[model samples]
Target chain A: MDAITVAFAALYQFGDAFAFLVLSACGLAVIFGMMGVINLAHGEFIMCGAYVTVSGANAGLPLPLAILLGALVSAAVGALVERLVVRHLYERPLDTIVATWGLSLIATQGTLIVLGSTMGGIGTPLGSFQIGGYSYSVYRLVLFVMAIAVLAGLYALFNWTRFGVMARATIQVPHMAAALGVDTRSVYSLTFALGAGLAGLTGGLYAPTMTLVPTMGTTFIMEAFVTVVVGGADVFLGTAPAAVILAIVKSAMTSWQGQLFGQIGLLLAVIVVIRVLPKGISGFLLRERT
Target chain B: MSGKFVRGLRAVALTGTVLLGAGSAFAADPIKLGVLEDQSGDFAAATLGKVHAIQIAADEINKAGGIDGRPLELVIYDTQSDNTRYQEFMRRVLQRDKVDAVFAGFSSASREAYRPIVNQFDGLAFYNNQYEGGVCDANMIVTGAVPEQQFSTLIPYMMETYGKKVYTLAADYNFGQISAEWVRNIVKENGGEMVGEEFIPLGVSQFSQSIQNIQKAKPDFVVTLLVGTPQASYYEQAAAANVNLPMASSVNVGQGYEHKRFKPPSLKDMYVTTNYIEEVDTPASKAFVAKFKAAYPDEPYVNQEAENSYLAVYLYKQMVERAKSTKRDDLRAEIAKGDVCMDAPEGKVCLDPKSQHMSHTIYLAKVGADHSITFPKVWEDIKPYWLGEAGCDLTKSDPSEQYTPSNPPSKS
Candidate 1:
């Protein structure tokens, strides 16, 4: 067996996986936790966000501006979906899942008709930053920062604002909250939109780091699902931290074993976590829910 | 010969995100090549190898002042290894980016889906991965060896080198079935016997049935064409079962599916045919591998999908330079000339003038225990074994079996 390089390289890979995990998990949980919808189409929304960025750049828009346009477009799309499709599905989780899944399939197929069966890249429009030997793509670091900031902002939205308080009450006890004069329906719509907006933000953020594709979101979604599930779907806020831990663990696993064994081992870990901590580590975060 | 199909690809994409600014072709602007591949799906590992090929090609072209003094810009998107998404991503490149040309995908299903799309768009498509052949069209050049190219050489080689009996397993899709028919035909033609021919669905698990059958049949060589995550599970189960295959080969086995999923003994010593095996010698290939290794310091080279995309970018640059124009049709016409030489590790890229399908040299090799291949003949220019007359007339049977392998063994 080769001598495992348990050095700084391990830390770098761990950091990368950690960044990806935290962002995607937080993104998904924000949608699922606040919205209470499985939102299978969440991944497609991410891809759409990537396309929006690419399209804007193709139109000669500045990189930062193009990405902004992408996020705005993605948010608009999410908001529209919420207003149109998701709003109606309030109070129904399973229905939302099936409906969103259908939307995902249609959107993917629609993208196929639009993009053709090929992949493309957005030039590394941003600069880079080197930490030791690992020259991390500058955009990736920026995205990581943005993800953390967004998580904090979203935290503020929940803990520090009246909207957050109402949203929390609605999620915790809709019947009682409604009896107490909370407008649960609007809250559902607002939360779903916010979740989608986050997904769009992820797409926009990931665009520069990744090659744009319609199905790219699926890969992110799979990991995000594991993270959201393992993080505690109930705590809703536990999504990012849980996702980060799992991502780092997976990254470490891949660095130790090749990505092949790493993936299998991580998958096994996810299954085990799901089995043991069914609601995820977030269950620990939420004393009220537990 | 025809422009109808190519036009349809444009129609689908042109409807929405079409790049309307009709900027005249200028040397100042980079000659863009859209590289559509699956970066993060079941095929990600397999497709990852092509990225180096793409980057190296881009650098080489740019070093040479690109097409008519313009630098070549490579735009890549992940298909997530999904055919439907592959089509969508391709459309964005052509209609929106309006790239000079496009190189895309690692699977035959994706190629098939993109065929009509490419036809309608009338833009160049470098379909770089090996797959089952048959559907030929304009604006699309199938770079990887077709069924005829791969199966004809491997079947005869297997029968002559190994015993005459053969066992075949392939995914039950357009790519697999078409290639499977050709394999069966090649064996019959070669005077060898085929013991069994099995077709598994794309994601079907529970390979005990197929594994047991192959063992019971006791074929001299077991040829496989399965791909994706399911393949990993199949290999693991087969390894666990301890069913040592007589001798096996595949056009689709090097996709990194077997690397992390299966153990050492599994699929070892298996002979395989590919346009690329990492061991092929070349400075360009070396640079590509080096850069890729640098990029993903901890990860092993992914596979052909990335390499093909790399080749696609270079091929586009070569064609555009030869044509001295990036006005779509002119480059497509030059590619149609089919005589472009690629500075490739797998020798020269032999383009088919009529179909624009570049028939490059294929490598014949055997896999080692550590999931690496040792290519004996890294560059072998096997003639166009397009299975011309041997191809079952699709008009006869929708799911036809008109194939006749050269070495006809008694299938169990």
Candidate 2:
């Protein structure tokens, strides 16, 4: 009975870790899946959003309003960054990597300077709640809901909206879309902004769990890359399944000393998979790109 | 007439900008002390006390009519507690702003990131935290308790009290590994057999095998050289699993999680070894405690990190006054002399007069309810691992001074 209880407790603990993984995957899908841009600046976009929310909240703004402003600010910054910096680096993989890397640093430090302090955390109301004789995280449940909404909204936008249709068409055949009198450049810009806005929304929502810091993006960004690349960049929803699988596998690896090994193992496995199947694990699962 | 006026105005504007720039450069500024620490990142929660302590010290110093009548201006950078950010903070402090001295950071990772930079710039950095020791440099002053301070007190306390076979749990990095090594040596040397040892990753949540191994061994006590979320969750789960075994001494267990992990009431009687405690029954310590609680009522009690950082500021003040110069070489020489004492919790914490490291007092405390812990007595004037029983003389009136190498600090 004691062993059963302990196992249940461990499961609950792991469930909390899984919630963050899901959040990271939610951000990764759009940047990698829909628009097909390897956004190195995605993490910066998240960091900017988190910092903006913190600054906004610090300035005595309401929580919901701050979050909206944070996402908007992140999108504007993302749009400006894409226009001035990432736009030039398009089709140049090596150049984009260097450029986006610089942009991440600048965005992180710029936020730090503007905030003028190191510490930032939202006043969240997440307490452990027991349901049906089992412990569950209230905030984790909220995060799950938020991610679903974002995912659903994203699916609807890509399928039902004209702008999103143009985006998908351009993503599928940029030359053909251009020939059909579609402004592909503007589509790219808007798609990039949309991707950044989602990343920001994720960050703003995630800020309550972890405290805000300048380089907080470093961890989340790396996790985003891992999720997007391994989950399959072609399928918009692959990151969801990828995150679930990653979280469960990590849950099982608790006996392997620590979560760090689990993380390292995940990275290692991703590397091996990428080497063997350059198209990612999702490639084998999803026969078609769309 | 328009062209002539525009040219004249442009020249005046250019001259004004240059003058403003040059004027601010030489503005008889107060010596800037950079207080770099993890403010709002992973390590920030654990390191907040240390940063707060620096602020309190700076406030006190200013109230004391400033260092030699020139107020010390503290310019703090939040490394957001990231190792990479720490490097940037180091660059900004040493390369660009060029602070007179830096009193920043805790933990081995942050120290490792900042040490090379400190050496490269030959800038003085006062490291203020207890660490697994075994490093020395000219440009750095370690004011915190060393491995000798932490282990020597705690090891003796654990060995004498329990007399059980020892198994160790530590964080897996240079500091953690070194801490485990020290425990192994102390246990073996002091007539105890270690059944096993394990290293947990910095941010891990799993400790099943470790606990299973511990159950098999059933050692007298476990010493947690671990920190952050890993330590917290492991203890919580371990406790729930009835692995409610006590630690002989938890190095990273004080405010880090000593009171945090327990259920309705926090874990009682968790033995911890640290240099400073909030419950010290001293006039100076009491005042410091009151001041802190009043200033940041929502904040937690004083951890060793804060006390050390606070000491670093005062340490700089004393050194600067004694040396009478802001020159790096002169300040280093003054601190090397080690003739310093202030109203600190340790009651006159000072340097080694030679190695430039502080061999401050280390106390053993047990936590209680109401989020307060008490220290009965500390091993005062504790002999460091580097310092033997017979004592080593640092100052020698010999021909060594003949070199007069033009460097005030010899970096011995």
Candidate 3:
């Protein structure tokens, strides 16, 4: 392949991982990173979002509106779940893992029994465009753009907004925030809802590019977990850079060798990063500032 | 005290006498068979239809006065799409339920998992799903299309219609690996060249890199041996990328009814060769489809596995009647006799006495944008000789091994 072909291939590969990580982990980053509560049902939240989009679109709403509705539905569900179950186990992170895992099972099997195994998913909009001799899907590029926008939007929300500032403060010291009359309980619930809403948006955006099934979330969850863990507790700065690094490594490795080696390169990069940097790429960046 | 104890004993004796009388009132007990399937997980889409088809067949048999005045009873269990559960439930079906025969196992690995237990119990394990072929065992019967019947018919047609250069993508498993080998053989036999081949790990859904690589290679057509719910996403991804190359797969659309699940243009123009498709224009197939549709009005579609499952029940019934008993040893001997055959909805299906694989008709089908299948060519009674080619003759000797490719493709 020529240099331009190679470049385009690399770009597409990068986009693939970047989009996957950003969308899947953005929600997980908030729930796991900020709250220190392992939400094993994070993937199920995405699944719910996908289902919402399909149902909404089928129910005569426009596609974009359907996607927005999906996110809102997920947010509502996240809030309800937080109020009902997660609120009781705020300090118990391990317990949250077990609880969320059970929730995931119920969600998965319930979908299977209710919706049936195979439901038709929407087709990917936008046709393909050629770069040099290679053709690429416009939908894939849309995912990449969406991932960046989500990252930026998240950064602005957490860094600029009063709610973001209050959330960060609440997470840093719940008792202090509570004493300051900032209702730590509400903050936790809203933060979890925000995270879950992001996961829903991810699912709605991705529902078109893949076949939708009750078990579709399993495909995205592993990579999401890896990206989040490798990125560390700092949601925006950590997850963005982590996605980039992992995407580039995976894309390049896949192009050079094959799919198996590409995946190995990703896992190996994570292992090496977790071992060497302990606190992840963001931690190392923070320590450098000191 | 003596009078009270005697009165209690008399009551217990009366209860026992009534229970025994009720038990013997039914002239013959039902012939119990085990039905193991994945009802709620990854394999559910492909396997659930087969489970329902089994039920329909058993119900039909019982309605027809059953075999020798004995009703056919199915002890069904959902394996939950877990391979470990296959063995656990197989043990239950064999030892606990003590079923005469078993109709289970969707994937090749799942079959291998439960085969040992079935063999130990001398139980007849009937698998009805398209496979990579080359399995030689007397305790098991494969009533589904194999690579030999599928690729032998489809590959040459693909090569002729498209070109000699082919690219292969398969799931990274025993079935995928073995099936890819057969693709290589067929491509070579038909004077084609395999330009690129990749074995993808199961559940790796993202295929942008792989799609781009295929575009770079620029093969005339692609042969996908992908399996499972996740791997099916490749077609959607590929379609999105506008990789317009023709693709042939025996694995994808037909068995899982992927055509119905996926949006059009993704599966459109895709080629599939199988023993049965819902759109076969034959009178027998039409009648079967009508009955199946009436029976399962809500099912997405009655797939090849479902048809095979329906056939397996009748085939077993034939063997039972031939043996004149439901004993495992007698059933095995009857199966070995090689006189078992069924005029199934798919076509005439008969067991290859040597390999215990079914010999049936194969049809070449193309998927329309609307997910309707159209059969262009149908080959009748294509024996699964791929096992014979591998020097497996179970008629002469009982060998326990899965025959692999004689000349495997070189790892790139």
Candidate 4:
């Protein structure tokens, strides 16, 4: 590969990792960061979204609308799950973990039984363009943009919206927020739904770029969990910075070494970050900001 | 009155015992066939349909009055795609259930884990999945195409059709690694050049760097030995990037059925060689396909693995009939005597007596824009006899060693 092509490849690799981290981790960050609920079923939510996109696209809906519907359906399901199960397990972190893990298994196996283990996937729309004698997909660029947009949208929703304030207040001090006449219960449900909804959107977006299998979530869950863990409990400050660091480290290492070392590099970075700053990168940032 | 009732009950019990004895005398013991497959988990995508295919074949045999009036009883267990589970269950099926023959294992790892257990217990195992090959065991009957059988036929044709430059990508495991070596050997043998080669870790979904490298290498065609669910993403990623070079693969369509899984045009312009594809329009294949569809109307598609499983069950039946008994020693003796060939969906499938591997017709097919397969040529009865060339003689009854590439290509 020529120097320019190598440069372009590196850029593409960085973007790929960034988009992947954002897509897989952003939703879990919401649940784990704000609500302090470890959602082991986060991957399943993403899988559900992917399935919806595939079904919707096959049913003749336009690609964008299908993606939207997939996200919405995931959110609806998330809301329902939160109401029926998660609501009862609040403040019981260990119980929530077991509950969500069980939910993940049920969702995965249920999909397998109902939809079969594997299904045909939708073609990724938009084609490729050449740069420096290298062909790069426009759809990949779309993912990069979508990742940034999701982050920006979530930031605005949390920082500027009234729902965000109530959610923040309810989560930080539920008794006080409830005493002040805020419906803490509804806030928890909405926040959880939003987290799940983001995961669904990620799933729908990448559905076109992957084969649809019931166990697809397992592929994404490891990275999601790692990123969330290293990012800490602060959604914006910790998760975003951690994602960037990890993505850069991963992309560079992947290009330099093979994928195995790239993953190893990511894990090493996570360990180093956590050891240096026990609360994660964002937790350090929050302390400094405060 | 009590004495009379007791005498009547005694008479009835004696008559019932006599009738039960008569029934036992008339009905023969069923031949137990053990089937272990990954119905759920990572391997489910490839092995689930195979379970159904095994069922259909067993049902067909039972309906045909089984082997000489003795019914065939299929005892199946789900291995959940785990090698440990496979090891655990293979033993259970053999020792506890005492199945006459075992038809199981999918991945090369799973096969390797269970191959010895089958031999240690002096059991009959028929492994029927296309693998890296070169396993020669007396107790095990391998019914899949090996690297030489698949790639030797495929690479030469690909070189003739496209140019002599090749780029290869493989999964980082025994099957992928061995297949890549064979690819290298074949490319060298054909006077072709291998411009680039890479081994991808399984479950690495991102392929941007690999794609870039392929473009940089500018090979005439790319040959991927990539496997599993995550590896299937390469097609979509390649398509999205418009990597327009023609590609040939031994893995893609056969096991995972990626041709049917991915949307059209993604797998378009790719070539694959396998023993059976859904598009094998032979009368036998078509009939089998129709029967399968009739049995399970909602089945998505039947690929080579399912067909191979179906063929394995029938091949075992053929062995039993030839031996005239379900006894393991008799079956082994019959197999060792050679000439275990039967007509299958993919044409005549024969067991190489020397190597315990299969010899069968291979179809070189291409993916259409609509996800249908089009066979350009059917390379008939290609004996993987080269496995014997690798110095494995099953007739010697030595199951201690496996064959590996003697002259692996130099890493470029």
Which 10 consecutive positions of candidate 1 chain A have the poorest summed lDDT?
A1-10
lDDT, candidate 3, B1-412, per-residue tens: 2558645644543332111111232368778778888887888888888888888887788777776777787777777788887887788778876888889889888998888888787788889989998778878889999998999999999898989999999999899999999999889988899999999988888899899889989999999889998888888888888898888998877777778877788887789998987878789889988888888888887788999999998988888888898875677676678767889888898887778899989989998877788887889999988776566777777666777787422223
Worst 10 residues of 2 chain A by lDDT: A281-290
Second chain alone, TM-score for each candidate: 0.81, 0.84, 0.91, 0.90
TM-score of each: 0.55, 0.65, 0.94, 0.92
Model 1 DockQ, alpha carbons vs. true complex: 0.02
Q: Residue-wise lDDT of candidate 4 within A1-290, one digit each (tens)?
A: 48887677788889989999988999998987667777899989999999999899999999999999989999999999999999988757669899999999899889999989898888889988998878999999999999999889888888899998898888777888999999988898999999999889989999999978888888888888888888887778767888899999998887777677788999999899889978674552243211
- Using lDDT as the measure, the top candidate is 3
Q: Is candidate 2 or candidate 4 better by TM-score?
A: 4
Residues B1-412 of candidate 2: C-alpha lDDT, one tens digit per residue: 3557645644543332111112222334577777777765556556777767777777777666667766766766666657876776677678766789887666688888888888788788888877776554657677777767777678777778877588888888877787788788888779888977777776554444455556656788787777654344455444433555567554555545445423422244467877776666778778878888887775655776777777778778887888888787787667556676565776767677545668666677766644356675577765444532222323331111111112122335
Q: What TM value does chain B of candidate 3 have?
A: 0.91
**CAPRI grade of model 4:** medium
If candidate 3 were superposed on the true structure by all CA atoms, what would the RMSD be?
6.9
What is the C-alpha DockQ of each candidate?
0.02, 0.12, 0.66, 0.66
Task: Summarize candidate 3's per-residue lDDT along A179-221 as a digit string, tens digits.
Answer: 9999888999999999999989988988887778888888889
Query: Between candidates 2 and 3, which one is better according to lDDT?
Result: 3
Residue pairs of candidate 2 with colliding backbone atoms: B50-B305, B50-B306
Candidate 1 per-residue lDDT, tens place, B219-284, comes to: 877887776643434554454445566455555454553543344555676777776655556676
